[model samples]
Target: MPYDYKPYAYHRPPGLTAPEPRHKVAIVGAGPIGLAMALELAQHGVPSVIVDDNDVVSVGSRAICWSKRSLEILDRIGIGARCVEKGVTWKVGRTWHRDREVFTFDLLPEDGHKMPAFVNLQQYYVEEYLIEAAQANALIDLRFRNRVKAVEQAADHAVAVIETPDGDYRLEADWLIACDGARSPVRAMLGLDFDGELFEERFLIADIEMAADFPSERWFWFEPTFHPGQSALLHKQPDNIYRIDLQLGWNTDPEEERKPERVIPRIEKVVGHRDFRLDWVSVYTFQCRRLRNFVQGRVIFVGDSAHVVSPFGARGGNGGLGDVDALGWRLAGVVRGEAPEAALAAFDRERQFGADENILNSARSTRFMSPEDGVERLFRDAVLHLANRVDFARPMVNSGRLSRPCVYPLVAPDATGLPEVSRPGAVAPDAPLADGWLLERLGVGFTVLAIGCAAPEVPGARALALPVTPELAARYLGGAGAAVYLIRPDQVVAARWTACGVEEIAAALTASREGRT
Candidate 1:
């Protein structure tokens, strides 16, 4: 018998109408954000269809690093442990000027933080895990080789025209989300402009397998001598694989290519005469652009479709994953009939705020990566030297503003006039439980914290009180006298108070659950 090597696109049988008149969310592009949104919806028992044009998982390593915040989201969906197994934790990194080492700072030792630093993992691993989990989820329909040909939004529902191997079909959904890449068709379909400054420098990211004397630690070389305009960054992944990013100066040919010999020369310049085999190499330009708006009618933009920043600060992937975490829970609520359509609007206000902050951080990182001129480089070097001498100047050397998650002010009023414990804008901080459990353990669903009182007698909420264990309490609650914090399903703070009162607690719950003041 002859072998049949036929290529055909894949598609789901057909989407059933939502059980009730629920908000149906149709996600385009089954990349990280799309898969993450599917997992989030599945956890909440909401129905969703995840469609993508690419039939197979990605081959290249696009996002090789995850921030402290991204890992927490994975934990909630029950993949955090698996992710930890495949990923390596980096607590410290060194900044360099040519061969000279500058000041080193600890990223994990900050006050009230659970994890020390970021985790370096292959982007494909994240997608692999999410895909596996989504396949097991009965509520989520994962459709591969299915592309969104067109999107039409109506007052009642948004319709997506899907192009599969079989043919094109129309899918009517209550909402359409775009997790597509930089050149987003959905964004173009809606006639939205991605407005921001663009960087002209070209860069090459190469992953290599090596067995040599290279440093196993993370290092960033600032303005190396071998290439006057080039800077090199080395990150170690699982197995003897390392991700090497080489800045290939400004004003290069668009068709300028990178040969293995050219890449090996740069690698040898940094890691003294070490033998290594290159695995994959890709060259691309960088940009710092974001869409003018995130939400248009029933459709919303997310991931690279919404914003594209220079990879200097590692904000490109991190920012998009943050969008998945933020929008997932709210979309789940709307689909589950727990919230109104108005709740979808908050996705715009919140995600746009995050996008704005991260892009600015990317711009700052770019400034440090490629300084304007010799004068700027001299000024930066002097500042670093001064940082070494002064105690307080260390933070100035390391931009504190860049490391932390951007906090958006709560627009609606909660039980307390002050911000709720894990309000929408705030990054969810860890808390303690009387049972010696970390607050993150309760992240699978919405958590309510009641302090200085008995656990609330609510049907859906689980509460904790003050005067916890000496060890566990100190580890999380930030000391015994601190107030209680109610965490949302998305791992964001919901509400907090010095003492728990039924009325105040109820108000906090109402605002988060109903999206109203």
Candidate 2:
């Protein structure tokens, strides 16, 4: 089948064209976030150029876990199936104390979704898969082994001066994105302050090929038998590869702890066997940090560039992935002329919320895993034990605690007069359709969903009516409430009314097209 490549509704100015002008967006890092953003733009028929300093695709597996929300975003970009094939699905996790299971939770059953609880795939593999998916589109161009020497941002465009192996060149992009990791040069060039704390303790992440009798489940040994001061986490990866995280005692030397041979012997003491062959071992001291702002001027930071979460709950990579998914659709709108330049402000507000929330949750999880003092550890254990005892307690702990789903309150509204619909930031719920697709499937475009009512006259945009049945009514809107909801291209609830009148609908659609309320 021939590919469908639709041009953006708005075109670049014709008079100001360079001989080698290629794409509209310039992505600074070729990591997962940058790759995902490029693929997202490709789906919208908007071209982008991904520039990176690495000569080849990243090899080391810096990230090892994926959450449910990340999986859904991959599916939206049409690469979820390939990712599932390469990753190992994890549904249950065991919290071990003194080599005995204390708490075991089934993550998949908790969500009540068809998707798995989490997947353990090497970060490099995920990057490779996305890069391959990007090849199908003419919009994504990968420029590797090129260091960006300078980036000068103007109101309309960003000029990146890159130092390639051959020579120096200047590249211009309408908008620029920074997905570079923790030591972000782009952020430094912009003179942004990354304000946060760094934990003094270090940990060793060792990848090994071992024959073990342990069950294939995620295990976190909080209070372990062999180590009194340190905790251990054993996560199984693909091809009999296992990632073992051994927390270094508070005073262990970094140089001595990172040496593979030295790290292996310490791991052997805990496992009671020295049979496993170690593949790679690296010692890392993680920090709990967050950027002051996710967006500065026209340059936006995603993933590690935005925040650095300790590897306690595996939130660093997952949090970054969420940032790209949240920002991609909105940025696409600005590029396509469906939204205004001010729409970018909402990206800053929403991602800042996500970044702050993830940072706090990860900090709490880290504290629980490795409590600072006696009083803190006691409170942590008591909370978990209490949760196990009471039903209501479990819900309290699970309230936006374990990454169920994120609902944003509108900081910037796209419509007016509908107080219920104009709430600051709300993600439209995923409504399953009769045809087996989802309401999210309609997200690739500007969608106006008028539930149970005639297509209310949205003067400037496309509106899709969600047939309001008794079942649909009970699920989405209350019986007394308006069955019709206007959904924006970004899958945000725009304007909802009890009745989708022509005037109300038109006003909502016009505001969204104009990109503000």
- Model 2 misplaced stretches (Cα beyond 4 Å): 1-19, 110-114, 211-216, 269-274, 384-405, 411-426, 429-434, 450-461, 465-482, 495-498, 509-517
CA shift of 479, model 1, Å: 6.6
C-alpha RMSD of each candidate structure in angstroms = 4.5, 6.3
Residue by residue across 154-210, what tens digits does model 2's lDDT show?
887888887765667778888889998988899888888678777677788888877
- Residue 512 deviation, candidate 2, in Å? 5.2
Best by lDDT: 1
**TM-score against truth, every candidate:** 0.88, 0.84
User: Which ten-residue region of model 1 has the weakest summed lDDT?
Assistant: 1-10
Candidate 1 per-residue lDDT over residues 1-517, each given as its tens digit: 1112233346444533223233377789887878887787777777788788887666667787777777777777767767777787776777666666765766676445455368888877788788888888888877888888888888878887778777677787888888888999998888888899988788888888777545545777766786565677888887677888888867665344477767778777766677777777888787778887787888888889999887766677778878887787887877777778787677777778888888887777776666677887776667667765777655555322234566766653334333333444576656445443365566556666544445665445666554554433443344345456666666666656556666766677767766653
> What 10-residue stretch in candidate 2 is worst by lDDT?
1-10
The TM-score, computed over Cα atoms with residue i paired to residue i, of candidate 2 is: 0.84
lDDT of 1: 0.70
